[model samples]
Target chain A: MPRLTARERREGYQREYAFQQRHGKPFFPHVVFHDTIVSLIVVALIMGLSVLWYVQFGAIPTDPMAERTGGLLGPAYEAKADPGVLGYHPQPDWYFFFLFELLRIFKTPQLLIVGTIIIPTIWMVLLIGWPFIDRNPDRRLSRRPIALAIGVMVPIVLLTLTFYGSKVPAEGGAASTEPGAAAFAAGACSTCHVLANAGTAGNVGPVLDEAKPDYATALALITNGQGAMPSFKATYTEDEISCLAGYVATWSAAVGTTPGPGAATAKDYPASCEKAGGLFAGTVSSASGP
Target chain B: MSTLLPPPKEIAMMPVDWVEERSGAISFGKFMLFRNVPKDISWLQTLGSALITVFILQATTGIILAMYYQPTPDTAWMTIQWITNEATLGWLVRGMHKWGSSVMVVLLFLHMGRTFLFGAYKYPREMTWITGAIIFILVMGMSFTGYLLVFDERAYWATIVGVNINGTAPILGPALSYVLMVGPEIGTNTLSRFYSLHMLVLPSAIGGLIFLHMLLVVRLGVTSPPWSRMEPTEGDV
Candidate 1:
């Protein structure tokens, strides 16, 4: 942008270049060694935190039977009303929530390409092609209005989506109060299977209301895991399980009719469950701690 | 007199000096390790070096983790649980690897921002920036593939969703999704494919491209800020 003769420009550049050459430090022991030290410190910090605090993993993969039983109950229940009564709420990691929220908002099958594929691909292309697109040699932020605006806007939008994605819906029906419902909730049987009496909306497993298995079939499946459902034989005793199977069978048989002795209390829980404390500790307050 | 017996110092250095005599390895090391950059370059410029460091951490810890990890629907979650909860200080190694990934991503974004902010991608440094951009994409691919190695419910469902998103890509979408899924559905084959990509393919590609990027950086030298006193003259160009 500045007018100058070839001779003056050459002379001016030579003087500046020599000045720069004399002022810089070597990369090896200077910058490289400093970087290495910083990296080591970071690693040390991570290791220290890991030792001091345990990284808790979520409960073992969802037990499909839970959905049929009424969905997750007791302390583990996330009380969020799923958009549909049968669809499992699929939550992606926090980092991917923006995209997940995007998919949720644009729910039409026809727009899947636009929401899931086209938009992300365009962003990736823009990121990769940025150096070429903004070729101005000026390094000042004020000189690059368009690039600066995009850099700020992208993160703002992503953060807003992530915040909204994390919020659970508060509209799911209230927790059931029946004895059979208590067992279903206590055992976390409502998370994967759909049961009308239990009021659980999960669809990871077969709908118990539709399948309408007999008491014998229900007992057998409860004792031995089927499909994605884990065997509860080890977690619950014969008396507790028998009661549960009968309760589930009664509800399944009366799916469209008045619900069977529809409510349960701590006294109704088997003595074996009494020893377990957390799920069947007699008192309703302690049975499902927040 | 010295022709009869060389000094003790010379004798002590004989092995290294002998190797250097034929190979010029010492000089090459000196050239690489002692390269100069402008003094005004601050900690902001260290992001690239930080990325390289975190990458080294990821590769090291990842290899260690892979030794005990099982890539299967039934075993992957259990094995990862074993590593974090039971294996001796496995938490430290796994935690470092996990945190290292976050650090690498952050450092990469910072490095790219710095390069752009300083206009380092202009002129002779264009190839350096291009190579860097390629490496950036490769690193992201590596991260995404590595995410599925845990094989927990989250991992399984995430892959399902991710693959479907890939499938929504117009004409090539279905084909790419099929290739990634290793079939119409995700199963053992899909895990193995992602494992191979995470453990072998992407790392090798990234390593090669980073080497090329470093080569270009060495050729043109790191660029300066717009306000820096020094500028390349016509003769220097």
Candidate 2:
């Protein structure tokens, strides 16, 4: 089919106007009725969801330490924000999962901008510029296969991204009772590095479990820092640094290995934990008991 | 009719007539309400109105939530707890706002899909689509800024991540992050900034864009479902 000229397009609209005026129904009773019904349904659904969320989650717990587990919808709220603590995972609301997943895909520092700013901006530009790009006047789905395919594909891709994004493991696994594990978490090592024994999954730096750095390497990095990882020399005493290094070396090597090989024995923990002599020592005393 | 007294109906309409005579609001209301729309317009077309309804709900509930919502870092979380557990219907209001945000986003995508499928954005309706797209972006902005107002663990960390992501833009990344965070950290300044954006700036922009969007819709008339057999005939009525 030939592309309609500008004049033809204007005439076409005029004809559509006349046809609508002749055959169409009044907006008051016709369109307004449908709109009102849908709006009512929307309101009801929102209210139902609110009730269900509240009923399932119940109330916020009085005990701050007690778990505030949620039912289907999710918790009424999570624990209060503590900027001092970095052990918790950062998960955005579900609607933002696609962008969150995008960040994960383009994880490298250089490519992060592509996922964070460039791609989304381009997508928005394309969205707003779509009408001009698809200038063909055809509106029928069968006739406009390209638009239909795009229309279907965009949502499918978004839903897929959202599904995968939601599936990404929550960072910093459950807190452990082990003193060395407690020290590793409290020292804020879990904020930048992942370690299995500590149940931490931070991605800001190396995965200690994967790197499995030895005691010497862990001590040097912890004391002096390297690259993006900040030095903890001023922050911790010499003994404390050694204790953290030993903890990392032990757990990182022990993961996936038998007890006899490279694993640091349970006996090694108490000795170094005692030397650290603070919260680390306190946990050691508690772990040993009277 | 003019002898001693006017009828009760006319008396009741006197105030309305005064306003209408001054503003032309009556004629405009009639024009908006009684306009013709394509007969085959599907139920899917109602999604736009449904979105507006949800927006109104959000505004109403957000106002109530804001009444008790303190924006300081020290008290924001406590205020949310107080609202949820202590205030009457607070959970309902907060939950609706929370869940309503998701619903609004879903409906937005659905509504955009409908418009795309119908080719309603073509030619004369291009401005409508453009304005709608801007409104879409602004709504997402509302979601981002509003998330942090909760001040829970997830909200705080997620916002830090979000602002960091914004900070990654090529030339302006660091500057943008600084502005958004108001400093090196997400402190008292950041919380208040987000509150202002979520409740005041973003909503005002969205409200204005929505008005323009609706005005265009009323002007251009609703598009018929693309599959309908109707075609424009070049003949006098």
Give the runs in model 2 whose Cα sits over 4 Å from its true position: A64-68, A170-290, B7-9, B231-237
Expressed as tens digits, the lDDT of each residue in A1-290 for candidate 1 is 33456586456545544565566677877778777777676667556544443433334335521211112211111222211122233455555667766665554445556667778778788776777687554556677677678767876787798776665432224435434555565344665456766666544345666666666777787786432243456557676676567556656535444543422321233343344443333343345532
Ten-residue region with minimum lDDT total, candidate 2 chain A:
A257-266
Colliding residue pairs in candidate 2: none
Q: After best superposition, candidate 2 residue B159: deviation in angstroms?
A: 0.7
TM-score of chain A, every prediction, order shown: 0.44, 0.67
Candidate number achieving the greatest lDDT relative to the actual structure? 2
Chain B TM-score against the true chain B, each candidate:
0.92, 0.94
List DockQ for all candidates. Answer: 0.29, 0.57
Interface RMSD of 1: 7.2
Best by TM-score: 2
